[model samples]
Target: MEPRPPSEWEDRVRELARQFSYPPAPDLRSRIPRPGVRRPRGRRWAWAAGAFGAFMLALGILLASPARAGLLEFLQIGAVRIRLQPPPTPSKPAATPSPASGAIPETRMLGILDLAGETTLEAAQAQVPFPIRLPTYPPDLGRPDHVYLQGMGGPAVILVWRDPMRPDRIRLALFEIGPGALIEKITPQVLTATTVHGRPALWVEGPYLLQTRSGRWELRRLVEGHVLLWTEGEVTFRLETDLGMEEAVRIAESLSAP
Candidate 1:
């Protein structure tokens, strides 16, 4: 046995046996599912589906209601704010605007509200945040022949001066705005920019439509020169008169506690 130590032929036979005698690999092919056939089992997918459904439901509800247009057009100067909106559909073709793109419905410019109630000067002053002022330069103008309180935005004070020259004619109207003032869908025939006591003011002259309520916009005529709008303290003032600009400014400057 010592003489027969490993021949070259025996070594080659041993090497061949080692190459063909390895163990079989585990069955990995059956463990993993096919990529296209597998479905997601995570809660993430469920959450994503629910979120998408909720968004669609909210969008549908908004569209079902009366669609309101966003206020893309508006102007704010001093204490007054103006909003321009799409006009209501008229049965007949509407008249072409005088010069501006849109005008306030007439109803608001003259008298924004139908005021049936009257109050004394003391009572009216107590209800509003701002003091009611009367022009003192024109002594004849005296106390407001008519005092009306209306809620347009907040509380509004209306002071009417009857024409001394003409019988039963309105000479001037002064309005004090509480909280603020709003003019909707307004396109003025003439608009002037000026100042009073170094405070910025506006003069809106001519005819325009104004809207406060949804379907109640009406056109108002400005037979007088212009409407003077100015703000003092926390309140805004609107003055309508037949007087000239200087006279209007004088009246505004003459505002004193009545």
Candidate 2:
């Protein structure tokens, strides 16, 4: 291979380079002292950066998901939306109970609907879709004497059975749950699961605490005995009576469409 001749600007370029010598790079490594002294700070900064990156990644994942937005946890069913977590601690004290009614005053967050009325069985059945079941064990008991509708969470059928021996005595409050309703099982109530009519059922005995517009009402009016809860198809049934567990089970098993 033959050596090529230099260009016309080669000498000029070399002269210019020599006139203005390239400056040496500053020793950044020397400026940064021994690694031992700064090791803790570097580690802390590294950890902070890593944590920030992880948080950003997690936030991105949460935002990407359309199902869960923001921090509030919830269970959505049809038109109803229930919080999976208890509400945030209230900043203000709860409203005072009323004097005349002796019930918790109704508020935006709290509500109540007393459906106990002197209505006929046929009239109540005409309103809902599900077949209302009446206990067949005590045939003489026949149809419910008083019917009530729990019109709050969902359309639920409340059947009252007056004492056979004493017609004035209200003995039972049975209810049938409507479709897509959310049943919130709160504290202070003994919740047990048993089978009735070969179907899984939840039995609640003793007093249970609940929040209502009537303030906080401990539901123990006539439910001193126990409650038998069972679901048939999309509908859920609950029999609130002062009867024993065995009797409740027997009654639940004998539930037949009227």
Candidate 3:
């Protein structure tokens, strides 16, 4: 009985000694403090990064909208047209002619509505503000009742028209006035429609300079049934001065194309 008891007791004592001798790794709690500062700092940086990213995304969406994009594009394209000429010079004066000739050879060209028996050379001169004759050539265009006025003057040309039948409808035509064969019908896009001395007209492409032939004096006329625009290389002239439409008609009524 005594030997058995020694064996059991020795085993129990050995187990207890081993457990206490290990001294549990220095209470892990002391090595690491509560709520370490490093973790919170890292979390703060991540939150700030996420907030900044969100703000940039919102701003990008607003600027890319369709209406704002179109406005930006519109600012890039522009449209403009203009014409310039030199100052007019003095030149030889033109002679005053009898209204009956109904033809002005000095005039580089002329146009009129042929009235056959109704309109006469004598009648047209009486209506014009200055001495002028009826056009000798046929109507410039088709077999239509309306007549077309066209002519060239040195570096410039003259264009005008009226209805022979109506005698009231008048048109102050335009063509390229230059050194070469006058380009009939100046590019309309190059001119601006306006009222010059009360008549409807298309001014040469410019801020206010009306004529196209450089350094030439231009003459503009508008009467009850007639309208005229003429120029001599350096000596321009205008006949009917005021009330363009009405004056244009009056002058047009006086025409009788030969």
Q: Highest TM-score among the candidates is held by which one?
A: 1
Write model 1 residue lDDT over 137-203, tens digit each, in one string. 6777789877877565577777877677874567888877777545432544545555677555667
Give the worst 10-residue stretch by lDDT in candidate 1. Answer: 60-69
Q: Against the true structure, whose lDDT is highest?
A: 1
lDDT (Cα atoms) of all candidates against the true structure: 0.58, 0.53, 0.30
Clashes of each: 13, 2, 25
By the TM-score metric, which is better: model 1 or model 2? Answer: 1
Q: How does model 1 fare in lDDT?
A: 0.58
**Cα RMSDs, all models:** 30.4, 28.1, 39.2
Runs in model 2 lying further than 4 Å from the true structure? 1-89, 93-118, 206-221
User: Model 3, stretches more than 4 Å misplaced?
Assistant: 1-166, 171-179, 182-218, 221-258
lDDT of 2 by residue, 1-258 (tens): 899886434543344334322236667686576656655775775664464344333333333443442453542222223233344555666554221112222222111143333356787678777777788876677877777654435566667777878765567767676885554432213544356664445556533223333444333334456667666666777777777778888887788864
Query: Order of all candidates by lDDT, from best down to worst?
Result: 1, 2, 3
Cα error of candidate 3 at position 95, Å: 10
